[model samples]
Target: MPMKGLIWFRTDLRLDDNPALLDAIDKCDEVAGIYIFSENQWNDHNESNVKLSFLIKNLEILEKSLSNLNIPLITLNTNSFKSLPKDLNNFSVTNNINQVFWNNEFGINESKRDDLSAQILNNSNIHVSRFDDQVIYEPGILRTGQGKPFSVFTPFKRRWIENFDMNFLEIRKPSALKKSISLNNESSKIQYSKIHKVDIDLWPAGEDAAAARLSNFLELKSRDYNQSRNSPILDGTSRISPYLALGILSPRRCILEGMKLNNFELTSGNKGICKWIDEIVWREFYRNIMHSFPKVSLNKPFQDYTDSIKWRHCDNELKAFYEGRTGFPIVDAGIRQMLTEGWMHNRLRMVVAMFFTKNMLHDWRLGEEFFMKNLIDGDFSSNNGGWQWSASTGTDAAPYFRIFNPITQSQNFDPNGDFIKKFIPELKDVSLKNIHQPKQDLFSSSDYPAPMLDLKTSRLRAIEAFKTAREFNNS
Candidate 1:
């Protein structure tokens, strides 16, 4: 009798180049895979509808692929991180399995779950194996001369690129069907999604779809990415974030696709594509940061100095902003887009995040939590890193003094107001010049609320608050 194994699928959904999956196939004569819904994890983490819906759809596609490979997916409805081990063990013993395998996730609770699962499985002497698949490099892949994690991005990026090569990014494809062991195909023991995910019309699931999105972005839009990425109206960005977030697409494959578009002669054309690749590296940077400072996932700001800085509990104002009646066209547009589309452009994410955390004098965590609740592409590291960057509360943040003026950001980024017009129909009648500052008009939209607070006044107040906090610390 050969050793049968179980592969627990978490965020790494793609079949290509997964180190854990490859290694599992190599060592086990038979392998079965499962994906647990973990409802509490999603609720506690504030995962948005778009993300939730997208994940379910992706899992369905994943289930089909696994079925084709002779490994039927077992959908576990368990919610608690502590509940995983016993649930997995019960299945393993019933199925006569010997080992459990999975790719490791590094978030605070995710790590806890992995730890508890490993221990419980060990008690039963079921060998558990995990691997790194999501990131091209692990947490300490690039470090300073002192072996400390790089706090700043420029030097970190330089070191990251220097160490990056194609081989390290490679993942093995799905094993051939002939190699799979026979399974009980007739019995419908597991629960399958009866209703199609409602919002899935917006995003297609499956590995093939992820590949197509990558190909389309690299070939058609990537060269113009530098110029268009900031323009909210243009298809400047890859729009593959949902795929990336759900792990339907691999970052390794993303980098390879980017390299295909690279010219390396000048950065504007082919160079622009390389610059877009920098965004992927930025995602890697946050992951590395989170890994280095486990406290980040524990609700501690990357920069602890922001702790003494008092954050206002402006629930009414926060409610107004979240409802997309912020009176700043760009900010409102971004929020409205989020409500309708479940996604926001990368540049607009920065602008709205800064405005909420700085101009509104609200806590960055509040805004970060809101983003996670609303964004389809929300992931812990990226969302937290983005909000902190905008709020000037991060490890490598925008200088507190260099705050983004909402009106100027709108005019500069959504110059034509097409993105604004798409989300905010009340501003539809407003001209481009005044569109970004529609609140400057005598309360234009009866449907939309006026500016919750004045920008300049709030800006000064936030700066003073930070200065006062820092001043007391120095004293």
Candidate 2:
């Protein structure tokens, strides 16, 4: 009998640099791929429609790619993760798969689902193998001298650099199997609710498109990344997050390409290249935080004391913030950008998140969920990590008192207010001097709303709230 293998596709979607897919190809005579999607799972996780649309498009492209390798892609829909194990087992048994291979997913629910699938498969005499394709290191595997997971990013990054080996980034392309798998008829078309307002054209699907985007960024813009990344107007940063989020591209591919540009220097090279690589490391650090601290995944703040925070719940304020009419140009611009484009600049993300959590005095969880609901590249770890950092409620969080003045952030990052004007067209006629904080008369004359609240007072209010929460925790 031929050795038939099953490749369980998850977030690590691409064939390139995918150890699990390569392993299946190397060990089996024929292989088939399965992608199990759950609408209930997406809803529970607050997944964006834009992202789901992107996923479906990418899967279509992936199906064609796999067909070229003589591996058919079978799409399955389950109600939720609870049903996935049985679904997986039935498929394997029906197909007579002798082995199952998959890349690891680190989320709590994902881990649990994988565990159940593994147990079920092992009991059925089907061998299961998994590999890490997302990060250079498996989450929580790296530790500090005290044997605890490092919460601080700089120290963690230092350790990541020290332990890095070039061999870790090695990739081998898998060729077509000698024999073909006749499972094309079993492949089902993916079904998704299309409700996104974003222009899908902004993000092209497939690994080839992803590779081209990376190449363009490295060739044309990486050297100036340090200077231009902060500016929202400049296309300084690589817009590859959507690709990275879906595993259309791998972190190793990103780092390898980046390092190639930097002459293979991990830390020392063009300042821009090194800084860009640091952002990728930061993503891994957050993943480690998610794995090591399960409470974060449970919707609990990493800092226990933050539980005492008395977060305000106001519908009106939230509505204005959501609609991008908070009268804060930079904040509004950021919100509007995400609403229309399904993505936001990193610097603006921090600025907008800080304004929402600190100045608006709202719950960080709300803002975090909103981002996940709208962003095309909403990686839970990165979104949660960033919101918690802004709200001063998670590992390596900003100091409670270090609230950002959005106007100043606007001046520093979007000096010409071009980004603001581009997103909030009502403010296009507003002068540069007052664009960040338009005068009441300008707001009265235009459709743009006036500043909703006094920044100085709100800043103080947020600080006091944090102080009171700390005192209450201590008492």
Candidate 3:
């Protein structure tokens, strides 16, 4: 009898550089692909409808790609992770599958599900193999001199570079099966009540589209990325984040292509190329943080002192912030962009996050959940890390005193107010000087509200709050 293997697809959706998929293809005479849709799991995670739609669209594309390789993609629908193990085991038994392979996921719930699935498969006399394909360096591999996981990113990145191997980025393309296998057609339709307002045309699904976007960005805009990425008006940064978040594109492929542009130099090369690679490393760092510190995944702040900070509960303020009615032009613009596009610029994300956590004195988790509910590129680790960093509650977070002045940030990053004007048409006639900090007369005339809170006053309030929390925690 031929060895039948199943490749369970999760976030690692792409064909190229997929270690588990390649291994399955090499080890088994026949290979089948499976994707389980857990609506309960997605809702529990506060996943966006836009992201769900994107996933379904990409699965359709991936199905065709797998078909070409003579491997059938069987879609399974499960209400929650609790039933997934049994569903997987039953499928394996019914299909006479001898082995199962999958790429690992780092979330607390996801880790538990995989562990249970492994046990179920093993008890059923099936071999289960998992690969760490998400991060170049698997979690727990890099540690500080004290033999502890580095909580800070700088040293983590430094050690990451020191332990970097070019072979890690090598592409692994799967060969086609000698004989075609057929399975019952399974629809990948995902129906959710809440649909996002984002234009689907802006983000097309598929690996080819992702690869093309990466190539275009590298060929045209990568060289200027360092200088231009901070400016929200220019399309300097690679907008392949949604693809990356969905695993339509692999990080290995991204790093490999980026390295080719810089002659395979990870650190010493074009400043722009190195900076881009740094962002990739930042993503990996967040993943490692998720793996090392599971509390962050469980909605606990990394800095224990932050848990004592009294976060304000103002529904009106949060509503205004969410609806882009916040008086701060940059914060309002960023929220509006996210509402309409299902994505926001990286700089704007920091600005808005800081304004929420520092200026509004809201809990970082609130902003984190809001972003996850709306962002197409949302990943738990990155979103949580970013929010906690802005709130000074995470590992290597921004200093509590380093509150961003929204007006100053607006003037610096969006100098001409082009980005703000683009999103907020009511401010189109406002002058550049007043755009960042509108005068009372202009603010009223343009129908834009006055500054929500006094910036300096709010800054002091946040600082005092953090100080009190720290002192209390220490005492």
Q: TM-score each candidate.
A: 0.93, 0.98, 0.98
Q: Compared with the true structure, what per-residue lDDT tens digits does model 1 show for residues 1-475? A: 9778888888888787677777777788888887777677677888876677677778888888877777667677774677877887777777777888998887878888888888888888899998877687877678987888998888888888777666775556767444555544223333323332225666687788888888988888887887888888995788888887878888878887687566432123476777887888888888888888888888888877787888888778887888888777789888888888778888889999998888888888889998898877888999999988898889799988788998888878877888889988877787766777764546444465677778889999999988987887788
* Off by more than 4 A, model 2: 442-444
**In candidate 2, which residue pairs get closer than 3 Å at backbone N, Cα or C atoms, i.e. clash?**
none
Model 3, span 1-475: residue lDDT tens: 8889999999988898889889999999898999988887899999999999899899999999998888888888887998999988988888889999999999999999999999999999999999988789889789999999989999999999999998888786788999765444454555456677899789989999999999999999988899999999996899998998988998888899999999999888798989998999899999999999999999999998899999998999988898998888999999999999999999999999999999999998999999999999999999999999999999999999998889889989999999999999989988887888777884365678777788888999999999999999999
Evaluated with lDDT, which candidate comes out highest? 2
Which candidate, 1 or 3, would have the higher TM-score against the true structure? Answer: 3
The 0-to-1 C-alpha lDDT of every candidate, in the order given, reads 0.79, 0.93, 0.91
Model 1 C-alpha RMSD vs. true structure (Å) is 2.8
How many residue pairs collide in each prediction? 4, 0, 0
Report the lDDT tens digits of candidate 2 across residue range 165-278.
Answer: 999988789899888765523755666676989999999999999999999999999999999999999969999999999999999999999999888998897999999999
Candidate ordering by TM-score (highest first) = 2, 3, 1
Question: Which residue pairs clash within candidate 3?
Answer: none
How much does each candidate deviate from the true structure in C-alpha RMSD? 2.8, 1.1, 1.3
